[model samples]
Target: MPDPIPATATPTLLYRCMTKGVKDAPESFEYGASWVTARRGMLSVHQDRLECGDWTIPYSAISQAVLFKTSQMLIPCYILKVRTATDSYQFGLSGNKFWSTDLPFPVTREKGRLRYSAFSIIARVILIAALIWYFYQAWA
Candidate 1:
């Protein structure tokens, strides 16, 4: 028998690599863990040991999903790529059943590329300018 699923499991817990949208949104779940579950179909994500925000992705809004390998060295792992009309998100999943889902033939083709936003673009520009200034000062 499968181990019991915790009440805090993510929305994709039921269908590991689901491409099909449910007729209605799933139920909300909360746990005694540090993170708070504000609504259904949401996930708590952590960055740099700090909780950034909850991933409350509506089931009907998910246009596509992709499973890809992660860079973890200890073991071969995979994460789920969720794409909506306005945003794209990634989620660390526990199971390896993503390939079984009926994804597109090309799997949406959003992986392995640098996705830059306004902040990242500005950062890169600042970095380039700083490097040029440093070189000019050193030469002069």
Candidate 2:
């Protein structure tokens, strides 16, 4: 018989966003540049590098990850809350709906969209400041 699914385990779903023939078939779903981690019990995921990041509490923390195959392609999948057996686990964009996978992210709450708009404004201001600084330095 298959192992029972844990009750505390939450379902997180990610959608694949890859276009055709861009990524090598073998390494298409795996990420080389970025990774994600979920703070225990918080439904939010944060991006960080593999080596220089907080230790993820294995099997307890869940992360929904997607990697760029190109700017146009994405490989999305749901990673089961699993204990880290090895030093690193290979993340694959498997289409498997193992253990009753459901998209943990809710459809409601447009908070992210609003937050991104705020970020856009802040970024514009920072760019403007940087330009001013550069020009001043050049004229000085």
Candidate 3:
């Protein structure tokens, strides 16, 4: 009888090969560029300001796609060291799934984070007040 492949070995093989899977881009995701191509995994970026007025944002994270689902997904990975140049930004990210809708992609993890801008808050308040005044006048 043929020997059964060990569960431990399964992951090793998966890491070495790509799988055909379904992909999606949620409407809430907006960063870099996202698309469902023939590949699986995510690419993360970081930027360094050079003295020449150029930006160096490299793809510094690559992890194996541990799970790919329509809902919550998870990837066990780490970011690579930044690669910088005066005229460009170069880095590499390799994981099992490069793009996913499950969980947060590498950079989009900040979507739910606390970002308080006084200007933004003030703008919202003014807009709301103007809207209320318009409606009140229209009704009166």
Residue-level lDDT tens digits of model 1 in 52-80:
13345554566765655443334544445
lDDT of each: 0.41, 0.30, 0.30
- Each prediction's RMSD over C-alphas, in Å, is 12.9, 15.5, 14.5
Tens-digit lDDT track for model 2 on 3-110?
333334434312221111211122223322223232222122222122112334222332322332111134333332212333333232233343134333221111
Tens-place lDDT per residue, model 3, 17-133, is 222212232223222232223234222221311111122233333221222122213434222222223221212222435333342223323212222355546667889999999
Compared with the true structure, model 3 gives a TM-score of 0.28
Instruction: Give the clash count for each candidate.
Output: 0, 5, 11
TM-score leaderboard ranking: 1, 3, 2
Error of 3 at 90 (Å): 16
Q: Estimate each model's TM-score.
A: 0.34, 0.21, 0.28
Clashing pairs in 2: 16-76, 17-73, 17-74, 18-73, 18-74
